[model samples]
Target chain A: MADLLTPENLVNALSLGALYALIAVGYTMVYGIIKLINFAHGEIYMLGAFWALLVVGMEQATGINLFVAIVPAMLLCAAVGMTVDWSAYLSLRRRLPLADGLSIGGLTLLGVGAIFYKLTGDTTHAWYSEAAHGVFGWSIVALVPVVMLALSIGEKGGMLGRSLGRVSSDRLSALITAIGMSLILQTLAQLVWGADYRAFPQESIPAWMNEPSFHLGDAPVLGKELTMWVVALAMMAGLHLLVSRTKIGTAMRACSMDQETAALMGISVDRVIAFTFLIGSGMAAVAGVLYSVKVGGNISFRMGYYPGLLAFAAAVLGGIGNIRGAMLGGVLIGFLQGFTGGTFTIPFLVMILVLLVLPRGILGEPQATRA
Target chain B: MLELKNVHVHYGKIHALKGVSLEVREGEIVTIIGANGAGKSTTLKTISGLLRPTEGEIRYEGGPIHLVQPSDIVARGLCHTPEGRRIFPELTVHENLDMGAYLRKDKSGIEKDREHVYEMFPILAERREQHGGTLSGGEQQMLAIARSIMSKPRLLMLDEPSLGLAPIIVQQIFEVIARLNREEGLTILLVEQNASLALKTAHRGYVFETGTVLMSDEASSLAANEQVRAAYLGSD
Candidate 1:
């Protein structure tokens, strides 16, 4: 308990809480628009880190520059993520109504999992090979075009928006979507990433960026932890700007408030919804990468579960559907975890206070209470 | 300015409009009268492009508008203030008015129209910031009319505007409708179960029974008709 009261613990709490807030934004955005608590969104984050690792790993394996390997790595991961949406989220969501699709999606994923484990059971001992040694040189340049293409496709009322819009309001559809999303993503992680923690070494990133420093203070301060928080804060600020100031952002807000009314107002609700998913998933992906870097480790596919839950917890703290609230809630949760984790009383007290103050989860949307 | 020729409408298994046809000439008021289950509301929905006719053509200003999205219909200057006051409850009165003129691009003109609406319904101007949900029933009804007027439609459609309103407020709303037709030269298609008020206010009337029109004549003549008075107005 005394150790937790130390300034070092406080700093750790703040940084971790900030990261939770950053990731919670993605969950909250998706929920705010569709009211879905995407269970597998955590997997999407995990997949992002793997993408970065894959690129850097391939670059090191082959005699390629860091610049060249990044392109294919991001592209491959993005394609995988998009595929996750297309094959699982879109396919099931489109085939039947929401309730039926959720059941079918779960069953189908389980069936696929059994097949995967059966096929790859013997190959578990094999090492990861460098498939693209000396692959083409491309920076994050290629990603811009791909994201733009995704934006365009989403604007055209892509499959998810079209199918879900038919059954219920955007809020209801989002909730169902998150459920289906979580299942598919969790299953994919279990099948592909396996149950082992896989990560790039600390030396993979720039040396200076990875180093931990202690300030000459009464208590210890970790520089590496501070950097992690700075990155998260930056991401949150950027997202806030993206949602508030831009044209697409305005359109997104319009869709969230009243989709049918937005459609009547000449804003294409489908396009806005698609953009929402892309941004949300993309944010989760970015968080995935940064989380790995901060921890100086690789993660199993299932790594997304704890953080996903925590991020969701943060969002609930903030008011699930409210963006600013989610961010604030995240920081609060982190601080609480930092102070009360090893000791029961303080954390328990904080949890009680939060529950009493906000029984609905920190930032949960008000309208979502109907269900 | 709007014509429905041999239009057919259905609600699930029940037919709502059995090949009903109607016309509203420019610069006039046309009212549709009927009992509870008659096709009065369906005709307005069809004309506003909310419902597509099962059979027949809907011509607007001689242009064939057989089928189109509802917003597009509003853009084409045919606006319908729907039945039972479908005001956005969460939004303020001013915001509701803004939504009414959603398709218009001219900022100055829109502001001007908003002011005009406020001038027309001073009560709305006073309650501009208040949420529609908090407003009284009569106030919400007034807001609905003001919202429709903000669209500045060439042809306005009102469905049961007088439904569930106090007698004085109903008279006030009908008076405003009459003024919009007489002074602004705005064509209107009003659907109502109140045959006396509709026929008295409108220039022409159509009597709907079940899903079809049983009689069509000048409003004053229909008001004087023995059958219309006996069956609808409860008059001698």
Candidate 2:
């Protein structure tokens, strides 16, 4: 008990809590807007970690510092997050017909092929390669648009029209898509950067990050932990201000309240959703870096799964859509995990117990209307 | 200021609006009085770009608006106060009003409009810090109208503003609408089930039944029409 009460344990708990809070905000905000649990968000966290590692590796070959790597990693992860929305979620939200989606997807693939054929310019010239590159590319450009145009023209044909009108009603499909996206991201990461854990190059990390910045009782507090706390707190403060004090933030809040009504108010619901993903993913990037640093630079394709699950648990524990709730939930879960043990059993049990008591989590507002 | 020509809307196989054509000139309060499921709300929604018409055109201020997004429609100064007082429940009254001016860039203009809204609805002013959900139904309706007015709209489309309110509150709301039309010269297209109150308040009226217009005339003529009275006004 005395050992648990030590300052060192307290600092560790706070650090862990801060990390969870940072990642949990993404889940909460996304859920707030679309009512979809973005299962792929954990993969975004993983990608951010890998991006940081990749950047750091480049820096070692070229002498760039760790701080400089943060922005690029964040930007790359943000792009991936937005792309996931555009490819998987947006069409479903718009209720575009599957046929339209297929045709559009085909057009997009054709465009990509055309671009590839143009860029590569048939240098190899083997019959299979030429057919694969040239014939397929040139044919798709003409064929796809004609097919799509015909579909558009024949839209009034009852059978085709009815077949094309299948639309998603709820968030279930999006949730499934998010899970599939997570798997795809994980597989791609494994293919690109082997399945084994890669240690973060400590030599490439700045001295300030690796060295002890101060002491808490008998234990020394690492610079990395201090950075995580400061950065996370700062980001939280900034996010709070943005959500409360800005026009975009107000629009976001309005959207979470009622999407159709928000759109009627001239708030671009789509833009706001994308912006939420960007901020959430960017924060996830920051958390990823701090987490990788704290874990002695070890990064694996599967590193994000447990932490991501814990953060999601944190989001639910706080109140899924409530920002402040996520912060509080993160702190509680971190403290529980850190003080009790690294194992997830206690935290998971706490989540279940808390949920059983407060059905909406700690701060989730009870929905007034069923719709 | 707004016109819909041969507009048709479909909800899957259910044709909600069939060749529904209407016009609202600038500074006029035009009302569409209809029974439940008569597509009055659908007409307003299509004009506001919440739902697209399967066929036809919507023109606002001589420009085609059918292809525009809802936000862009609002940005162009056409605001819709939807059927429900869908106020941001968790947001304070002031924040709700702020959201109304989401597309506006002029700080002074937005503030001025906000003040104007408060002046119009003194109850809202008194409860500026209160969460919208905490307000009474009448107060919520007032907030909804006040929120729409915060956009400084050239045309305001209101869908059933008197819904689920007491008689006295309904009178107060109509008076506010009259005052806005009289004083500000605001253009309004109101959809209502209360034919009596709507006809009294509007300059012109359209009577709807089963997704088609049954009659269109000056408000007084519609009020006096025997068919309208028998079906809608509950009069002999």
Candidate 3:
């Protein structure tokens, strides 16, 4: 009880919640578009952290500012994210029907993983060279605009978007695509980053900021956790603005509301869905970088899986498709997990509390129907 | 102007529309009337590009529009207000109207047109901030109609405007339709089960039975025809 009241616990709660919230939006958006929960979203999240780790590692050796290295890292991850969409998901939607695509994608991922393991010797650290780190700063800046433009073309002017324009309903094709996306990304990580637990260079900010402290009734309690809360709040605010104010954002909301109606209105439902996936995956990437920054990346291929589950749980707790609900649910769940650890029957207690308080999850809204 | 020639549409193996052909001239209120499962709605859906005919050609303004996307059809000046008021439930009433103008880029004119929708449906103006899902059925129907008009379509197709409405409310809807035709000179293709109400509202009508056209004539003649009276008017 004394530890629960400490400032460190509160801060940890906030940080974990914020991270979950960020990743959860990806799960929520994919679900909203196609009514399918993406089990592989966690792998994408892990890939993001690994990308940051790779970039930061290079910067550390090459005498470049590691902080400045983040720009290119983000761009690379975004490109990788879109590639995941195209190679795994988009191909599934185009080449074969949905069920066959899922089986093929899953099998292909397994085969690629085996090959990656054989080539890389199943080592995570060997992928990170101890020397020869050159600054890729110019290349990173040059690629950002090009990547953004490519994504736009893929979403808007691409043959996939055009062909699928009329079939605007929630589709099984989308689910198969998501599964294929998961396999492609995980395989890419295994091939490039190797199957190892690589760590980022030692940092002080997480330790210095995560120190907990509290004063209650003139008694001092120590160990504070505020950084995560601040990050989560900031991310939510930025996401709110991006979704509400942008043209693509408006089209996304319109697609969620009614695909047929949105298409008839000329909002380009396919392009909007693709854009939503891109933005949602981008958010997951940001969360990945932040996760590495705070925890000093000891990344695994499946590290994002647990976080993804928590985020999905958080998303459902608030309301599966509601954006604001996801944020609230994440924060609340973060606080719950923070306080419940090592407590009597912690898992059962948490489960009971969630069931009693939010049978639909922390932020779930009720169902709605129009006349 | 729209024309459907020898259209055959099937849902799975069940034939929903069997050899149905109809035409709507420019600047006219053309009503398609029938009993339930008479393929009335299927005809409208095929014409609007919502459902493709298994075999047929749909020509609009003298060009084939059968292969066009639904959005492209709207861009070509044909808009559809779907049955049972399929408005975007989560969006605010104003946002619902904005969605109707999704194709248009003229920001200032779009804003003005939004105001026009508000003026036409004064209740929509009052409850503009409310979600479309929260509105009453009658209001939802009105919002659906108003939202479609936001596209400024040359041809507006409505599927069953009088479904599940009070008699007084039905009268009000018909009045609005009459005013739209007279004042705005908008072409309408109305599908309704209520033959008497439809004839009163439309210039000409086609009576359909089991996926085939039974009769096509001026509304007044259709109203007075003995066979039409026995089959539809429900008068002895």
Of the candidates shown, which would achieve the greatest TM-score relative to the real structure?
2
For candidate 3, give the lDDT: 0.71
lDDT by residue (tens digit), candidate 3, A1-371: 67576655665566677788888888787667646677667776787776666665623544334445556655765665555554455543444433454455445545655675566454445344411221132233234334333333434446554555524322444554454455555545655565556656554223443343554445433232344445557768887887777656666777887777776665666567667667777778777767666665457665776677677777776677778877876766677776665232443356457758767665555566656
Sequence-dependent TM-score of model 1: 0.69
Tens-digit lDDT track of model 2 for B1-236: 89989899999789999998889999899999989999999898899998999999999999999999999999899999999789899889999999998888899998888888888899999999998998999999999999999888989999999999999999999999998999998899999988899999999999888788888999999999998998999964
Write model 1 residue lDDT over B55-103, tens digit each, in one string.
8899999987768776777788888887887666656787777777777
What candidate 1 gets wrong by more than 4 Å, as runs, is A23-40, A43-178, A185-267, A316-320, A342-371, B5-20, B37-67, B127-129, B148-152, B183-185
Task: Estimate, for each residue in B41-150, the C-alpha lDDT of model 3 and write its tens digit.
Answer: 88877876768898988999999988887878989889888888887887788888888888888899888988988888899999999989999888888998998998
> Against the correct fold, how does model 3 do in TM-score?
0.80
The docking quality of candidate 1, as DockQ, is 0.16
- Model 3 residue runs over 4 Å out of place are A57-184, A201-231, A242-250, A340-353
TM-score of only chain B in every candidate structure: 0.98, 0.98, 0.97
lDDT, model 1, position A225: 66
What's the distance in Å from true for residue A284, model 1? 3.4
Task: Give interface RMSD, every candidate, in order.
Answer: 4.9, 2.2, 1.6
Candidate 1 per-residue lDDT over residues A216-243, each given as its tens digit: 3565445556666776788788889987
Docking class of 2: medium
Give the residue spans of candidate 2 off by over 4 A. Answer: A1-8, A58-60, A102-169, A369-371
Residue-by-residue lDDT tens digits, candidate 2, A244-291: 998888888889989999999999999999999999999999888778
In candidate 2, position B38 carries an lDDT of 92
